[model samples]
Target: MGTPTDEDDGVAVALRDAVRTLTLDSPHNRNALSSRLVTRLYEELDRAEADPGTRAVLLTHTGNTFCAGADLSEASARDAPTDAPLGLAGLLRTLVAFPKPVVARVTGHVRAGGTGLLAACDISVAGPGATFAFTEARIGVAPAVISMPVLPRTDPRAVARYYLTGERFDAREAARIGLVTCAADDPDEALAPVLDGLRRGSPQGLAASKQLVTREVLAAFDRDTDTLAELSARLFASDEAREGMTAFLERREPEWAVRQTPAR
Candidate 1:
């Protein structure tokens, strides 16, 4: 396990036996996937892959929200480029194609691209009350880049329902829809059994097994990633997207949302 870098570095690595747990430490932003965080995550995962002692990788976080999705503040900045989505697409590819089993431990909420990261993991365990939603449509964009990994794992019916509604679903629904491995009152307890099982797999055996399981997912990435990324970037740069992001930052309802009577 490597010593944690400074808080500004955005990710921390802790090794427990053969498992390397990477914590998204940027709680100030609800562990939002900033460019620096994404790059450092890729680097750490790559390092774990190269290390002989590391057999599995765990993606966890340090806040109430597991991840709030892309950094909207960064995206809404007029000076910002569409590079964030491109980088996120690359990170999803890394997680999907990783030779080792990547597990995600979720204790809170996840939204938009965060769901993509969760879907790319080989296994994901969430607390019973943790919530998830695909929020791109609310923000005047589609979940294009994330669809690369998401579409294959999620039930088509569930995808159609949630993608269109942007409704928050609990962990149980996530598990039912094949988006999560399980939901437990105690997520760490739930993960213990999984990790105990994985620890017994041999290095070569695990590598080959991961390859076998991910073959279809890898093919999907290869077949459609560039097209999806382009779609993501185009939507991010659209006028409606700009208004949506601005409305979010200003804590106001977006123009597309109907004004409702304030509840007593």
Candidate 2:
């Protein structure tokens, strides 16, 4: 077992036998997706891929919140090149295609892009306290970039409702919708049994199985370029997007021009 290192403030890497554990360390920000942290995460994952000693990877986070999603402050602060880093996107793709088993240990609230991270993993175990939300719509943005990956884990109706409303749901709801494998009172205890089973499996067989599943899913879907383009343009131009960004920076509620009517 390799010792945990403190090189990256938002990530900790440890190797134990054939398994590598990657912990998101930014508890204060709920491990928000900062640019530096994203870069480091990609580097660490790449390293694990190249290392012969590593056979599987486990991703977890510290704090009451697993991940709240992108660093909104950073996103709003940047004047030029508003998109997330290309390397970050590449890392997400790599995670989805990784030959080795990738397990996500979700312990708390996870939202927006955080859910994307969970979806990219091969398997996921969540604590009872865990909650999830698709919050881009609330901020007048679209999750188009991660929609492809998340779609496989959830039902179309659930996606439509959550994507439009940006409402939160509990872990039970997440599991019921197929977004999570299971919800456990004790995540570590629940995962230990599964990990033991995985450890006994043939590495090559596991890798092949993952590849087969991915291939089958990808074959059934065609890229929706029109939808993606529309989302992109809308997010970039929306007044609410601007208001949300500014409100987040100023730590206040966004003043949408049109007030929502109360439900009867």
User: For each candidate, what TM-score against the reference?
Assistant: 0.94, 0.88
Residue 5's lDDT in candidate 1: 36
Local distance difference test scores for all models: 0.88, 0.76
- lDDT tens digits by residue: candidate 2, 1-264: 268854476899888867889988897778888887788888888888888777789999878788888777766653624446333344556777888889999888998878878877888999988999998877778777566567876888998999998889988788888788888898889888878777777878888888876763343223543455456445745567778878766777778636779999
Clash totals for all models, in order? 0, 0
Error of 1 at 184 (Å): 0.9
lDDT of 1 by residue, 51-112 (tens): 88888999998878888888998888888876777788889989988888899999889999
Residue 33 deviation, candidate 1, in Å? 1.1
Highest TM-score scorer:
1
Give the per-residue Cα lDDT of candidate 2 at 3: 85
Candidate 2 — number of clashing residue pairs? 0
